[model samples]
Target: LVTIVAVNQTGGDIPLSQLYAPNSKIPASGSANLTDYNRVEEILGDTSDLGRGATLEYHPDPNLLVAKTKDAPSATLDCSVGVVAGGTSDIPIAEEARIIAAESGLDVVRAYDVGVAGLHRLFPPLKEMILRDVDLLIVVAGMEGALPSVVKGLIDVPVIGVPTSVGYGYRGGESALIAMLNSCVPGLLVTNIDNGFGAAAAAYAICSRMMKKREE
Candidate 1:
């Protein structure tokens, strides 16, 4: 019969021979032996796993971590960015946000085509994100730009409003800009019209600060 000895170590498993005498004896079956056991115990006495520094060091893949670290600010904790768009036409702006966030080493999730006109589409993905606890939210919309206001009302997290120039007719893009500027929700922030990169950068700043605070 083979006996197993369990030792907790990080980075990978370490053989018993690495830590103990190689000439150690094995007990025979049915023998009430304490002689060999005592010797082993004495060698490892008073040394718990913690005391022995037996911990698994999680080293993220060098290539993956390096790529992310190259872009991210020198911070330890992970930050997340959530981007939402009002309609299909607004996707380009939302894509801009995603690209910027990704370049900055922030994990990004996208919720698209959830404009206020289709309220139901908004909540399912939005609710999922809220439950997942995103670090920041970017709301992109045009043609009245009411989506951000609605989002601000629904969630307490910081929302950066991006007014896309997707509208036409006499209202022009002015309607979107005015709607966002006049939003009733307190603490709702607005960026330049169609400036997805700016919105993403702002969100990255907020999330990076949060990560730094957590480390402190």
Candidate 2:
């Protein structure tokens, strides 16, 4: 299994043990670090994944870790991922997903500034993705987060919605998250706010399964 680490903003172990009781959500995201040998060791003695055949990789951005097994997906696999950014501000997150998916051996293509305000701009790149037969679409959008649902309506493939912290008002990206969660589209999947990493990881899993089916 590949493991991804979400580093603490300040760069150290998250205070999960200290804050877990008060904030239930923190544990869900932070507790996974328990397997990180350098940080936590009590739970798993040989927590160093290298010995267990797990490899480690880091994101170009400092706050995240990625697992890239270059040989996992064969070069011949037909699966690819399409990434779309609803606006310029969303590109960094989209890039994160693209980099992770590419490193994990999935062919990745992109479309940018295709927000719903300019619906016409979305079609060309989308057409390219469809022509390439992309296995999944990672749509990163903010401000109402309608792009994912819109793209899902247009394409038959599954969509992964990444809500970024780009809007105003109550809690960070919660509005977008709510909008995505409320989508009527059946195959649209929603990741957490600013979680491009999660979206990529999910895309990798799907592509890996596709590759496996092809081999069989």
Which number leads on lDDT? 2
> Which residue pairs collide, candidate 1?
10-55, 10-56
lDDT of each: 0.62, 0.68
lDDT of 1 by residue, 1-216 (tens): 111221112212212122223232221211010112223433245223222232122111110110111111222228777899998888877876775565455788899999988798988898888888887789999988999999989988889999888856125557887888998898789998877766866876687678768879
Assess every candidate by TM-score.
Answer: 0.64, 0.68
The reply for model 1, stretches above 4 Å from the true place, is 1-77, 169-172
Per-residue lDDT for 39-75 in model 2, tens only? 2222123324423233344343323333222232222
lDDT of 1: 0.62
TM-score of 1: 0.64
Which ten contiguous residues of candidate 1 have the minimum total lDDT?
61-70
